[model samples]
Target: MATTSDPNQKTPLEIREIQELAIAISAKNINPTMLSQEFLKQTGIVPNEWELGKQPVLGPNLSQVTFQNGVSIVAQPRNITFMESIGTKNPSELNIPNIARQYVDKLSNAEYQGLSISPKSLIPFPGSENGARNYITRTLLSPGPWQDYGKAPVQAGLNLLYQLDRCQFSLSINEAKIQMPDQSSIPALLFAGNFNYNVGSNSPQEILEQLKKGIDDWSSDLKDFQEIVNQRFLAQQQESLFPGA
Candidate 1:
């Protein structure tokens, strides 16, 4: 099946507009790295405040805004995204038309088709979870463990949204404890908001509590979305793949 809007159908600009709208709704407000620094500075875990996001060119999403003491440190995006089929549950029903699918596969494997990752096909069932793995590797969201649920919110969120093309809602929450790249672990919280780059108040304590409740709800919501996907997916393929049902 084709996966593209009719060439004569939606105008280039209109298509772009919808895409933007989707992204706008999808953007989350969670940034754990920034929050950590804020907490350290504001209440002063140490006499001297640490220079966390002062210059802010650092963490995951690479924040563009400058957070300050007077800024608000609300929940932000720090988790990976995953798709939650909003209306329809059957995934195959929502498949990209062959035309648009070309983009999916093209945008996906085009890079690897001739690169060091060319061997991507050798990886096996390039169409199953493997496809998601390879498409992400050379194409969209960063590739990692296929069907990985352990990546942070950002990665998971991207997977849910982009890979599955489902409308997703994300909530920033706190972590029990995360070890920093430096291996010097610290307790941290995640939220979406502007904060003081160096010195500000971040609700680590609150974030944890909030996540305890919020992530759970969101996770449940996603599960509901997936149930729909699985059901729908089977429905769509039954006639062709399962026939005589």
Candidate 2:
């Protein structure tokens, strides 16, 4: 028997823009209070001329700093994360990876566990507020009688994990709303990718080398993510929204 495609079916969502990129390192005995602006300058982790975007948060267990260039550093007891808003800048221009490598090099005494490089983006669906929700419930998932049990429409999200040769990759898709500058909000899908690498060595030098290698391979991982999202998940589009991929 021949199966016919539904004519009323809507188009699958495509990635609209790259929203944020981040590098997070997990370690032991990390003192977040030590991440001061003066300490960052003294250690050469950040340029001396760079001004802070806001007042630095220095606490016993957590610390945070935002630079004027849209780079933000957040440190907790178990991990430290460096994030930057992609905006219109090319991903190649990002320096957070270099900064993270420098930090690990300088703080060689800390016991590093693993690191993850993540890229987050917004996938906008055309027409209607329920586009993303419908994509998840009706498209990605199998239809069953369970969907009719809910009073409101089903809200769903997906998380997939894949073990690659060099790293463990995970992609999460969720329904989200983005607020515009005019105070209006629109429905969208958020595609988040994480490439997690484990540093197996206890030696600081070995850990630093491992982390540097992960950072170096981040661009390729990002490209892989782009291919997966664009070719496999979303509409059949060959063009990439992310620059330098």
Candidate 3:
């Protein structure tokens, strides 16, 4: 099976699924031990009826709670992370960003440093593992002797960072093994994106407002990442791969 280089190809890619979406907030004064089911219910960060998937961990340095809805909130001494497995759901319906904003709103007195919104996806190569390897060496990178230095075929990964108008964006691409429901696994490429936003205000209230704005822009950022991968990178017309552009 040959991979299509036409960006406008009517056929969809083999597999494109969002694995996870996360929002991590950096704070200096948060106590992880304060996180608990009772605390969440009392602060109204989560609904009272929400049940935990497992027993909550209320340790001195780390606290975590996994909800039945696939949302997990983990709190460390200096950072709090809200994450969810998106599976096949639309990104617009994700609730982790809103929940992170709400948590910050409730704990308005913590000293916040910054926040990052991240999403990861898995896309399998159309053919075999060699086809995926060629994408990095032949398509992305120019042919050179550096690729042939090793005894075996070189396994490569790519990481890129860009400064956008609103935040710093980072993208990482690497090969991953995706486990199937039938106890099998297949090789795939993992695309991870992080949008880092810095709070420029000193007041906690102002910081909260800034975070809310960043959260609101998450959907657009996600779309930008998808476009970069599907349109710019994977969609380039390669004469060698297609045999006639």
What are the clash counts of all predictions, listed in order?
42, 0, 0
- How would you encode candidate 1's per-residue C-alpha lDDT over 145-164 as one tens digit per residue? 55456554222222122222
TM-score-best of 1 and 2: 2
Instruction: Please state every model's RMSD to the true fold in angstroms.
Output: 22.8, 8.1, 6.1
Q: What lDDT is obtained when candidate 2 is compared to the true structure?
A: 0.77
lDDT of 2 at 220: 87
Cα error, candidate 2, residue 235 (Å): 2.6
Given candidate 1, what's the lDDT at residue 116?
Answer: 7
The estimated TM-scores of all candidates read 0.21, 0.86, 0.84
Candidate 1: stretches off by over 4 Å: 1-210, 239-245
Top model by lDDT, which number? 2
How far does residue 135 in candidate 3 sit from its true spot (Å)? 1.7
Q: List, residue by residue over 159-202, the lDDT tens digit for candidate 2.
A: 99999988899999888776544344556678899999989565
58-174: candidate 3 lDDT, tens digit per residue? 899999999988899999998889998777678877878778878988988788889898887666543455766777777788989988886899888999999998889999887
- Judging by TM-score, tell me the better candidate of 1 and 3: 3
Arrange candidates by TM-score, descending. Answer: 2, 3, 1
Q: What lDDT does the true structure give each of the candidates? A: 0.25, 0.77, 0.76
Q: What is the alpha-carbon RMSD of candidate 3 to the true structure?
A: 6.1
